[model samples]
Target: MHLPNGIFMLQRVQTVYMIVAMLCIGALYLWFPSVEDAAGIAVIERSEPLVFGLIFASIALAVISILTYKKRQLQFVLNRLNIILNFVLLGVFVYRSLTLSGETLVSEKGIGVLLPIISIVFLVLANKAIKRDEDLVKSVDRLR
Candidate 1:
């Protein structure tokens, strides 16, 4: 029932959740197209500099978080930071979708718009798992 140092991290549920969240973010980069103009060209394309920056930043954070699994406290903090970043991304999506000067800003709502929500859900699950593991460790310490 006892796993050696680094091996224990591989068995943690939170790691799986983080990986899933990363996959969702990657999907956002590959398949989620943003707003379209009158002629049907995408205005805020996912490949645009600003959009790419936000997406890559999120991906990097998630990757760093996964690699920091040994430090539960740091992992928890990173997950929280990632969640906040996802919220900001979601806010941007909302802003882009809303009407501006009596004209709808977004001509199409793609799966990319929902990526943040999906990523948030996965991150929350990861955090919950991490908390559970921490509680278990604390209780074990009290027993000794």
Candidate 2:
């Protein structure tokens, strides 16, 4: 299959950052339970519909951002949207963690709860790189 010229090229740093962010979210599906009960049952796992949807949506956005490499401005905008979506996901995790009783059913909050923050950091870095690329292109155009 003949792919487009620039699509899927790993030449840019932003693409790597975005892929890492996507992987971080995807990792939640493995063994990272968001919350566990005293009985060792997963109180909140990636299988939960809401959590699943949010995670999938974030991943989709990252993929789309990566694919739109030719349009730097659009790619940058998509990254911003992805960042906002991650913030919403983080908010949901925080709210859920806060609502669960700490002493009783809520035994421990898993490291999965921090995945959104990690994803957000990568997204921010990706955006910075995208912006830098855009500025470089603009400066080149100015020289002409």
Candidate 3:
């Protein structure tokens, strides 16, 4: 389908993937308590500056990548950066969960902690689609 500027095609698979990744990252905001103590006190949450910045950055990257659909290489690179950012966020979650008192049981962890993994998965899928598009373009150029 055509866009106003003749760019930003919504029919692209990578665009859909990036949008899903953005939504996954955005979902963390809905899960207030990223971690809770045995007594149910919130230990870490999306409101924390570090966590907020990381999530916001991830979402921003997804949006940028989606908008840059015409530039497949840039979109791929942005997805890679987003994946790395998600990894850092995951590490932060793991570290926080591990440091909690009394062995960090699964019950103490919140759904928010898993959002990064989901986002990362979508980002990887988007990157793969972008790479495929890039390769297709290259083959077409070669055939010229």
Candidate 4:
């Protein structure tokens, strides 16, 4: 079983953070007026909560994978979900980046645009660890 170290013990807390972060992002998007620029980047500024929430979710998952004693199958399912989420996020960024042309650079910076890639990397690593844990479990079962 993976050891409960680092932030693994904070799953519930992290989830709460995630929910709140998503809400804040939604709110900011709703409040922001459409960019009036016609020839440059439309700065796509993001509320801080949205940024932190995403990073928090990634950290939470990493911690959960290390701390939980759940069966490998469930962990694998969670990892897959993370992967899907990452892809969706990446898609959003790609679309946004492509469309940002012909407008004033959006309020958001490149770091936010780059976050999906980082999250995807962490999710992949977490998934790999999950697989290793499964293998270890199988070996132990065979010993019995």
The lDDT of each candidate is: 0.81, 0.86, 0.84, 0.50
What is model 4's C-alpha RMSD?
A: 8.4
Local accuracy of candidate 3 as per-residue lDDT tens digits, 16-57: 888898998888876546788777778775578888899889
In terms of lDDT, the poorest run of 10 residues in model 3 is 100-109
- Sorting all predicted structures by TM-score, with the top scorer first, yields 2, 3, 1, 4
lDDT tens per residue, model 2, 73-142: 8988898888998888888888887787665554687888888899999999999998998899899999
Alpha-carbon deviation at 14 in model 2, angstroms: 0.2
State the local distance difference test value for candidate 2. 0.86
* TM-score (all chains, Cα) for each model: 0.84, 0.90, 0.88, 0.54
Clashes of each: 0, 0, 0, 17
lDDT of model 1 at residue 11? 68
Ranking by lDDT: 2, 3, 1, 4
Top candidate on lDDT is: 2
- TM-score preference between candidates 2 and 4, better one: 2
What residue runs in model 2 are displaced by over 4 Å at the alpha carbon? Answer: 1-4
TM-score of candidate 4 relative to the true fold: 0.54
lDDT of 1 by residue, 49-96 (tens): 766877788899899998888788999999999999888888887786
For model 3, the superposed segments whose C-alpha errors exceed 4 Å read 1-8, 102-107
Tens digits of per-residue lDDT for model 4, 22-137: 33334324443223233334444443354435444544554454344355576566556655755665565566556766444333443445555555555566566657767878
Error of 2 at 65 (Å): 0.6
